[model samples]
Target: MIKTSRKGEWLEIIIPEEWDGTSVQDLFRTIWNAPKKLTHSLRMEKGVRINGQGADWTVSLNQNDRLDIRLFSEQDFGIQPSYHDIAILYEDDHLLVVNKPSNMDTHPNSPEETNTLANATAYHLLSQGEYRQVKHVHRLDRDTTGAVLFAKHSFIGSILDHMLEKREIKRTYLALVEGILKVKKGSITEPIGRDRHHATRRRVSPSGQKAVTYFEVLKTDHKQNLTLVKCFLETGRTHQIRVHFSHIGHPLAGDLLYGGKPTFSRQALHAVKLELTHPFTEEKIICHAPFLDKQNIFTGIDPYSI
Candidate 1:
């Protein structure tokens, strides 16, 4: 594990034996894969130091050397802080995972909109004296409830964005569909495109981007003709789960946009778990959020147990 310390506005890291003789430039570019713009800004702002003194970016680092980077300098939260309560699932210096509730958008659509998970997260950080901007790594639909990941700093955010692009981050979802699926386990490989007729709708079109969804049926309610399923995504797209399931003739219950019955309010889908390798410590991190079955859509079904 990497040893890190926070001193005022700077974050200190002790060089490990594995990283011995690595140049600072390689650390930022090759190892961390930081953006060129951020690297330029760090160099221009003199935001990096070694052994308590400013050091050249090309200099090689030795084991046990103290490397300091100004990561926590005072900054705006970007979004207006909303004082609404948010449930934190996991927290660390680099990232935060929160259990997002239903009926709230992940981020604001406009500057005037403050009732969002991003605004609430900003307030949470502000209360803790963290002035860093609130940066969400990914977003869930407004009605879909689940675990959401947020990066505390831009450096880690860029790395996480890359991880997500590489499909290194695993997000599992629990949903209740309208009908019982014939297959217990299956994968949906389809291309999803925006619906030209509807502004917020997406459909499976050949001209669209690639989307893949894998699902397993956990439980089925024969009486109500509802199936509880756990879904995994290989590609993240707008309404991918809903679109894929609907394409297979099992639209999520209460999902009106996809031709589902109004058995409940909103879509019966929840982001149940998020798993990833910690960028700094390289530790396997898993975050789980409780399923929000407000209308008892999947009565007596415990998502955690499954």
Candidate 2:
């Protein structure tokens, strides 16, 4: 568990018994998920410490030794805040969950792309007088709308990211694909890799990293030749759900990149639910985003029931 102290905006966590003889830096990298780029600044700036004193990177830690790490400041991000209407589904001092709108990039891809979810979050944090770093735990595609989670600072961000890597943070998506699923529920265990034929696309390949997606058919529209499916991801990859479903001959509607027709302006996908156990509180937490438009295919049916 982690707690904050008022003295220096440092987050504190006690080393557990399992990590009794581990090096400080190694533990930070593995358990805390601190990236290598942050290591130099963390050391030179006295950003990390143990037992109320700056400790050596290779110092062995004892159980119950308190470790503190300084929070990354806002200026480090180097992005100007841009105002945009964003819906915050949940918020705590440690975490922020936003219902990201379609067509908005989850984070900035280039210098020219300032109007992104990160920029909007920066503006929101500034308005709240929280001049600290905004770190997204995971990413949603530009045209996919859903719950996007962010950590308010680096320490929590690291922990949350570790949880994500461990598959502790569960995400469920609603996808409208262009076919009637023959099966009620099934798993797609396919490896995905960069498509050499298409520069920006991914395809199922044996040389690629392992990817798995599970789906349950929720509803079918024979007239539209579409089926709404609830999807669970076992692994996260670039365009994983879209690519896997497309490979199974059910490309998401409007996903032209994957051979889907333009029935909708963008791919018909939404991250409807997120469930996880709070790292600090150890309590179960779940958040959801409501449908943006009632006119969509899932108007009358309840997603929870399905």
Candidate 3:
């Protein structure tokens, strides 16, 4: 069998039909049955997790074992703006790192002229009449908030692309989930692939690409779980954090697409920090978003749901 990812990629798997995913996509594509964009990455080959060992699909599966994969791609013309003052973290001649808020797309996809973060950037450019082209280095889902890097031109984008490939960029997120986590810390290592039957779903399969995410439980209340997790992206797969967390049984709160309860209308995940080097200076830059950090998630709200 073959597995698909959230980005519409495929892989071969040799296992029983009843496994979590015979192919690779059985892990992430749950909300919809869409294909994931499966890109290649040599660095993540070593990070692949198969049952207990790190593998790249060369090993055959046993009976009930599982496989995990993660990968990333960098390709977008511009952003789709929600028309808001996007918090600027770091900016220079070559590139800019914007702290993207939730409900704003990193770039425009199927629906055009709908006003997204990318469109806002273009609007900003038009105000100057220079009309700098938007080069999207990274993206965030419309309802998923976090840091997004954008380039002004293709030349600079090339450099940023190489930086991403080299694993120079690190993204961190904080999410509130709906569950009482038993483990203090854990890692969700799975292979992500697209859903062939549906257009927007993903699954985990031994044959799919590789993905690894490390998570830590901060605190938990009766209604929700507050976790301060650091998702190290060995491979920057699409919806990696959301899918992996969902796979681990702790779906983010308000994430209707990934087992999360629709509590806040949008997912409770926030891209709180980012680490990377400047495109030209090579100076390591770390940007932090100001979210009320209580170490314990339940500290912010009453024990009972309001």
Candidate 4:
């Protein structure tokens, strides 16, 4: 996943044999689905180049013509490094993935906040001579622990934003919910909207955006009245898993915000797996985050066994 904050970046691609006869405009329209804004921007500026010369939408392509396009760019946010620990899950020239701990915000919500995953990642990158700003692709609640991906440049981030819109990125979470659900497996298709009465709460509403979550019971502890489940999200929304499970009377353990018992300090949710295709390499990448050892949430079973 090419989640990043950098913009005005460039990408180079070789025209394939099958697209030899297609015009540059056709290629952008059909193959890349270039947004109108991008196409317009490229048209106005010398943003597109074929081989080594300036090219436009009307230019014809060949078997090995190189095409370069400039992607959208955004101004620097100027977030500073906090020099905190960020467990590096994967790193490369274009991307970085890390395991974010609970009690840490993914990114600072305000200018006054500095202790966030983004700030820590900035510090780490700077230590390695990465002077560019940090760009995170997704958001995890302050209490949600799991794999968060970042893009080192703006072009990669743009690709990732498209992937997110296309539902190409997959995230799997392990949750310990309060009750042993009657159904072993089920799907929650609900519309989630901000709670009108409470500024920070969400609820199922007819006018809300569509949200879907699929859950499978991994283990059940009837003695403790807790159930370990694997959750797959179909839509990325604020507190989707917590709110959906709570709506069905099985709020996550320690999720007091959603009517769950405070068995742990925070919500009993861990983003265990993330899978996506690399934007540049086209290779499938999968990342996993191990459960926090000290939590003791999985008291009766070895988490590895599951």
- The lDDT leader among the candidates is 1
By TM-score, rank the candidates, best first. 1, 4, 2, 3
What are the per-residue Cα lDDT tens digits for candidate 4 across 1-306?
A: 222222336566676677788999887676545567767777788887887688957867987787776653433546977788778988876788989988889998888788999999888887876665679998789998988988776656766777887889898888999988889999999999999898888988889999999999999989989999988998998999999999999999999999998889999988888889876445688888776537866566443443
lDDT of 1 by residue, 1-306 (tens): 888888887889999998899999999898888899988998999999999989689989999999999888778888899898789999977799999988999999999999999999999999998888879999999999989999999988999999999999999999999888999999999999999999999999999999999999999999999999999999999999999999889999999999999988899999989999987776889888876546766577665664
Error of 1 at 32 (Å): 1.3
**Model 3 over residues 1-306: C-alpha lDDT tens digits?**
333223222122233444433333333232112223221232244434565356544333455564433322233434443345666777654467776666667776765655577777666555544345677787777776657787765545665676677677887777777677777787778999875676775666677779887777655666434454445667777778788878878787777877777667777776767788664334677877654322333245332121
Task: Give the better candidate number (1 or 2) by TM-score.
Answer: 1
Listed per candidate, the RMSD to the true structure in angstroms reads 1.4, 3.7, 17.1, 4.0
Q: What is the alpha-carbon lDDT of model 4 when measured against the actual structure?
A: 0.81
Worst 10 residues of 2 by lDDT: 1-10
Q: Look at candidate 4 and tell me the lDDT of residue 105.
A: 94
Residue 287 CA displacement from its true place in model 3, Å: 1.4
Instruction: Give the winner by TM-score.
Output: 1
TM-scores for all candidates? 0.96, 0.80, 0.65, 0.84
Candidate 2 TM-score versus the reference = 0.80
Count backbone overlaps in model 4.
Answer: 5
